[model samples]
Target: MNDWPPVRVLEAAPRWLRKVKAIILREIGSRYTGDALGYLWAYLVPLAWVLAVYVIFLLLGRRIPIDTDIGSFICSGVVPYVCSRYAVNAILRSRTAYRHILSFPTVSPNLVGGAVFALEMVNSLLIFGFLLLLNYSVFGFFEMHDPVLALWGYFLAVTSGGAFGYLMASLSTIVPALSRATPIFLRPLFYISGVFYTANELPPTLRDLFVWNPLFHGIEILRNGLFIGYESLFAMAWVPITFILVCVATGYIVQRRRLSGAPVEGDASWAI
Candidate 1:
């Protein structure tokens, strides 16, 4: 008889999934415990950003020539951008934040990182839903030409963001200095990631350069879904998908090596 313990293997699979879920729930609960505002901040902060951008555009007498209202257009871009940004920042701190949990042999760093990613994805969904409701009610802007396509774009943005966050988390663990500089490096992405403008609006040369940006593709694909007549000539779905897979693979390798007590380049004292 084989001593492989097939029954135990089956049992352990569900147990591991349950553990990941428990970690996610615990993180969400602990994150908003002391704050009275709780999860409302997740929706409110993004809503506030949309309103602020709308007002700024109004003041500047600038208007997007798209079929939908400016508010809706901005919402499509900003929501995903914010979600990805926060996901990266949160994941970067996940390993250190959950260091105590990592002591258990069953709880790997990747599992903890997955928990953090789940928390951000949940928050992003809430924020996205709230924005949709607000836009429909306040601005009467519910012109979703292709809901499936739009959803696919949103999915890509969130997943890619989570993967990028995981990568940053792994990098920061090995290089402490990167932990400090990550935010600064990410600041410029907001302006360039097609958050404020569509790829079509840029000149041909500029559009060529911007097309290489993965987030820009996400925003443009999202716009294609929201606005009926809008065409995103530069949007390529495979680019971001490829980038996400690469980031995730690299992050996983680095995380596994570090967790296995292998020697990592730079100071790994920051991990704890």
Candidate 2:
């Protein structure tokens, strides 16, 4: 009979979790290293950004028209969008950034990009928490429609982002051009994805256009789940789930091919 009490395997679980935690801590530390203002600056920069946007929206006479509060409204969407951007960027460069360490058998290619994303998610949450605190303390906004849905939305976004990140990281090997063009492609998405406004306010034509945008759907559903207690303007879980499946399958296929020693070079970059 096989022995069930394997001390090494049990010990390895804690060790691996610790290693992952260490990676997160190291990434956070590196962000603040040599900066005079340090980590406070990290928290402050996003705060300033939100304040600027909030003031601008106020001047614009409530662009999205949130009757409850604007700061909390913006805070909900902005933080997640920022996290999405960071995750995409981090995953795209994970290959080159961790190329050295990836040569080792014990280290995983996904770990570098995934860890960066994980850490960034934590950072994003901290920023969101600050915004929540500010809204409650200063703006007198204390509304949480559906805590369960809100939590679910966060999990779904993180999962979708992580899966997409892994896929992009693997594809970068074959499509280096994507690495260059992805940022440019995603720029318009920030404003158009309904981050600063409600999708219900959009014109019929514009709403139709946004309905096709996957990120738009994700953000909208996420916001609805949290703000309206899962009463989304476009409540579709399939979109993000589909994107996750497609990306993961494609990334895994690409990883397998590359690991099998294919000549994966040249114009294959465009196909990705």
Scored by lDDT, the top model is: 1
**lDDT by residue for model 1 (169-241), tens:** 8876678788678788678778888888888788898887777777888888888887897988788999889
Tens-digit lDDT string for candidate 2 (20-120): 77667766666667365787776786677678788888798765545556777787667666667767766776667666666655556655666777776
The Cα RMSD in angstroms, rounded to one decimal, for candidate 2 relative to the true structure is 4.9
Off by over 4 Å in 1: 1-9, 34-36, 259-272
lDDT for each candidate structure: 0.80, 0.68
TM-score of each: 0.89, 0.81
